[model samples]
Target: MTQHRIRNKNLGLAELIAIALGGMVGGGIFTILGISVSMIGSLTPIAIVIGGLIAALAAYSYVKLGLYYRDEGATYSFFKKIYPNSHFSASAIGWFIIFGYISTLALYAYTFSSYAISSTDFANNIWIRKGIAIAVIGVFTLINIWSVNGMGKIEDLMVYTKLVVLTIISVVLMQHGTSSFGTFIDNMALDAEKSNIFSVLIVASLTFVAYEGFQLIINAVNEMTNPEKNIPRAIYSAISLAILIYVVISLGALFAIPTEEIIKNKEYALASGAGNVLGKLGTNLVILGAILATSSAISGTIFGASRQMSVIASDGYFPHWLAIRKNNSPQNAIVGMAVMASVLILIGGLELILEFGSITFLLVSLLMAVANFKIRDKTASSTFLTALSIVCLGIGAILILYYEFTTKWEQMMAIIILYLILAVGAWVYSKKNEMKGKSS
Candidate 1:
């Protein structure tokens, strides 16, 4: 039997939960909720619930995979174990995951800037926002480099903060109710005359971004105390909690703000909704929460992305230098990912980066589900559950792609270009390493 020597001890259930929540509750919720409301009208809450259900299905599949395969690479290793001798395919999927993480980090970094400005009377200067964003990226990157555990603790706090803040806002909104519950419910009923099912599906696809971070738990299994049991528990718990929060928050926004205003000013919809109930102070609090949420996500994502890169390097698919860890942390890979994310932040703009990240994540998730099915016979799971996961993943991928083409083509194209460049670079680097190894 081949010994899998990678150490499996760093994180606990709390850490896993923090990572999951941090990854999912980023700036997207504050920014995308309004846009989703605009697209789906009064059905925003239901749409969020639907998105959560889909994410939950994916989360279930990931739990099984995490339990069966206790590897550091998570998605890549799971897929490779399922389809042996498919290193190229595994690495391809790995790159997709890496791209998603990096893109998300960039998006959140940019959002940090926007939220910072809104939270304070910061003159609303563009250069000031950019400077603040870069500074935030720099500070978090240092934190990630210094200690993963510290990053985990910070993430946990942010998760709780967001949940509490959103809950308070929801309660306040309910206290001063708008348009009776019956009206809201009636509005949820889709009108065939006004919008087709396809349109609703497209809009629903965008809402899925709010649930993206649920899977980050699977990647953190290597750090978990009792991964086999705790991993599944954390995935289910975190995902359920996120769903509840997302649904309540989306409903609160719809109830507080007019649909027309949400559509017209989609960017600060959460702030607008909070302002309706808590006045300007509520808006400021929401912006602060948004900043915390985005920053927490950036920290978690950078940590995870670096670990994935370390795994890829260890496999000899990339340079060995990237695999080196200082004080048990992949400092080089962390800095590398941070630098790349910073460049992306500067070049692509937040909206474009977010769209690209969402699509990449969707593709990787679908691949993981397919990989789950391929390994079902070999693993310790029922065929029915495995098949269900695959089906759900397929549906999700279709929805994401449909939404991208209809509404996010330019961003998708930008992502495609980035992937192409990464592919060529990875290949060239691999060849150079191979030659050096042969000579040595």
Candidate 2:
């Protein structure tokens, strides 16, 4: 039987929210803060709000499509079922979404390791950090392979606990920061004058990846209870909470930490700033919060994305063996995802992974918006909102691409080459599935 056949509907509203929050809040603030602050300076919080709003727009289509189809495969399955005739489209979305998850998985783990090792003498050793990153991915993979319910409970603890730690960290930073509240406002005004609107928008677009995890809620449709009500409730609530946490913490980081310090210590920027502002005690707290955040995110991503991987594999877009499950979990797919993410951690630079993940999700989410717009009547979606989501998400994706082309053309070319490789893989697999159909 398919894994969906054994659904116990054990995931409730809280667990679902934890999963979504776990996915979104993971290492997002920790990594994005430095980059966003470097670009927009004191306007980082505003850019974060814009990014969160963009994510909300993306979530609208996901929620509508999710409820309409009730498919756990989510992005790929939604597109595939909506346009069943388009095997290549299904295959391509499957490849893109899975790899997107892989990139984020690597991102979170790398961030986790960066913080985990920051307090140690081995802080500057990249190899050790990467090794630890791979090791953490292995730990979460085993947790996910163990039990869905177990993972959910752990996620609840990690996500909720981190929220508290994070809030406290932000408050403490602000209270002890060199920059006063008035100074913060003045700096923001200064940044407004210095940074172009386009630069702020580009940073906002980059932050979209930080919000990519809410749709992860839909990936748990089979495991979740009351899909009709709980899906919308859990996802919307998670996104709202994420926005609040991101804004507060980002504002704290920007206020307390010098802009140059954050920019210079991009890998563990939050902790570095905490060290200078709040000293050892505060630095430890930030590191602990970051570790928890990234750990839960890694776990949540593995739990949600592996299911999609198996579904795609079952449909012949991936190796069929990955579809095989034990104890209602796609064990092989989980292992496959872990191995791949570890490989990425070993090779992928922080910036490259960040850019790859941001671009992939923005493009994929834009596709979801387009697909939702096509079936607005059936999904009960708002015409104006959906159209606006399309326009804004399109601009979000374009802004990132434009920024890369203008400044980082080589990186853009690398991303382009990666896309070409994925497209070719999709074609090959789709062809294999087609030939299998004929042979059978």
Candidate 3:
């Protein structure tokens, strides 16, 4: 009935950081590696760092509004309370954010499948990967529908374990990397000469998906103490750690594996290439790390996003059936969310899903910046930082749109049509709520 999980201030700063880091450092790095390398080559690290900065800027508004609102519903809840009279605006935000989660869900599962398929005999079988991705989504959907409270604890372990595994993978690859540090820099220098700033910026914009899960910290407001102190600390610390982790892993890969190999492998780049360079032991380590990273990412996304979906439904912005619950779980929303994600994996390729998710979150976070600006006084937000968030996030969205328009117009159009569909759905629900409000 409540917008958030039961209130319990048991999570400390360390736990808070883990939760935010867990939400973030998930499938993002795994999904973006090959694409970023392909687009920017040895300059991927620079683009990744820029992307991290962009995430930091977005976090400013979230932290400000989060502390002011102190509501666990987060993005949706913020908009709803802030624009209490604008049913359409609130409804649209809820719809956008929920679907945004769905896009990321598909990204994670697809990435998982890519890595899962890499070690198999049918590595090139697209249909088999799709099948595995859908099946994994189905499994998680059942666990959610069945209401497995214990999964949360397991998710925490996956988070910590994956971090260690990734670190080990990074170190191993760096140790056994075929290329020298000097060669790596020379390659980067060569890349810089060949590529323009726009290329790196575009890649940076695309990599924003890797930095998204930081907002999960606010969702735990009810479970953390000293909101004023812990919120910013946890979010900022987690983002910094994520940036470090990503930079290290990416640089290690660039040094250890060739650019063509990474680009060629695409989805399963790390695992596939690590075998040739780091041998069987190293390759297996990367696969295990990728699996844990993506698996937890998928589970966490479904759980958090489904809860938000249920809340949106309860508020009448989504299908009423999605509000149905069993054993305190949003069974209908869970199933509906799973079905949509599986459909996405079916139709869209990995890059399409990745770009769509990055764009959606960028747009949503930009909206949050605008909302924060409107209530700067109440939230005590810095006008300069808020404007920076708006400007930077707006540009990031534009850059992604620009890339898609020029190189992948078909995907661009698909994204636009999807938005059109979501907008109409959000509007219809908001309209229904208005009519019901007047009749009562």
Candidate 4:
């Protein structure tokens, strides 16, 4: 089949905002909050705020790169333009990001299925749940493939809806929450004394998952309107709003639910907390909100991952066929990402997917931070921010890697294996293409 070229266009502020918000608000907020509270007790809000700061630092690095590079491949292009020796490393890092995003899609798909079942009785049937999850992925893939613009609009709406839902829940819970100042102080006291510093670090790393969406804006920098300015604006705005929402929700849950219940039953703490404050309907509303949150995340993730493949293929790292666009969308990349994500859903399930994806994403953030440094040597501006970025990312990466090895060795290994395979695949493909060009 003849290959078609995929073109890039400038995306506007609104589009960038939609992509960032959509990417960031997924399954992590709805699900990870409960698990995080279990690990750090009432200090969960503090942990989330810390994670947000690290994420903001990383986002600043991207903004610096985005302003200088303004290329289609985002981090890949940034590293390639600034540190030619590390092109392969940058590409591999980008591949890890691709895998990370796909794994995120898998997690959201699973979460969507679980929430669907819990919200409605029909999801109890195993086959039904699997079918529904797969179908959701399929529908989202189709939407993205049909039109990137359409998907952008959908994501914009989803972001708004999720923010509103979470805000309402947080406000209600905060108003009705009954924890005494003494109880709050006591909970913090116990956490500080009983919990290991390392354990809090590990739990805090999970909160970083909530910050994942902001990077999605970078993937489509070429399509963004005035990316030089809007990219940073979108990143800062989305992350700031997300952090505020997370803190309120976390604090609300802490105050509304007993510490013992939250620690023991991490999976449904939010629902239980809502039930305590707002009754059955309140709990149901949170579930419905989760559905929106997960589904939006899943959809936005599919869009971002597919576009990454398209960008890579356009750069000649993959077969040109993968870059072919139909109706302003990368059809093959969309399908390929969907299939890979679906297989991961089947193999690792949701929990492993989240852990694996988080590890890969943390590593990529580190690479991007380094890329910022590499670029600063080439350009004179933004040196201070770039240096700050490197330090913050280095500290976060160390914490995340330490936690992964200690608490999640198996999933960390799985991420390593997958990354190696992608690296080798990219290398082999480049060599074969070089040979073909020589022969011709």
Please report the candidate that would top TM-score against the real structure: 2
The model with the greater lDDT, 1 or 3, is: 3
When summed lDDT is taken over every stretch of 10 residues in candidate 1, the lowest stretch is 1-10
Give the RMSD in angstroms, all C-alphas superposed, for model 3: 2.6
Where model 4 places Cα greater than 4 Å from the true spot, the runs are: 1-11, 85-87, 196-199, 377-381, 433-440
lDDT of 1 by residue, 159-253 (tens): 78878887787767655757667777777764434666666665556667777877677666556677777888887888789888877777777
For residue 267, give model 1's deviation from the true position in Å: 3.7
Give each prediction's root-mean-square deviation over alpha carbons.
3.0, 1.6, 2.6, 3.1
Residue 262, candidate 2: Cα error in Å is 1.8
Using lDDT as the yardstick, the better of models 1 and 2 is 2
lDDT values, one for every candidate: 0.74, 0.89, 0.82, 0.75
TM-score of each: 0.91, 0.96, 0.91, 0.90
Off by over 4 Å in 1: 1-10, 119-123, 190-193, 429-440
**Model 1: clashing residue pairs?**
11-223
Query: In order, how many clashes per candidate?
Result: 1, 0, 0, 7
Query: What lDDT is obtained when candidate 1 is compared to the true structure?
Result: 0.74
Whole-structure CA lDDT of model 3: 0.82
lDDT of 3 by residue, 305-328 (tens): 776787788888887899887656
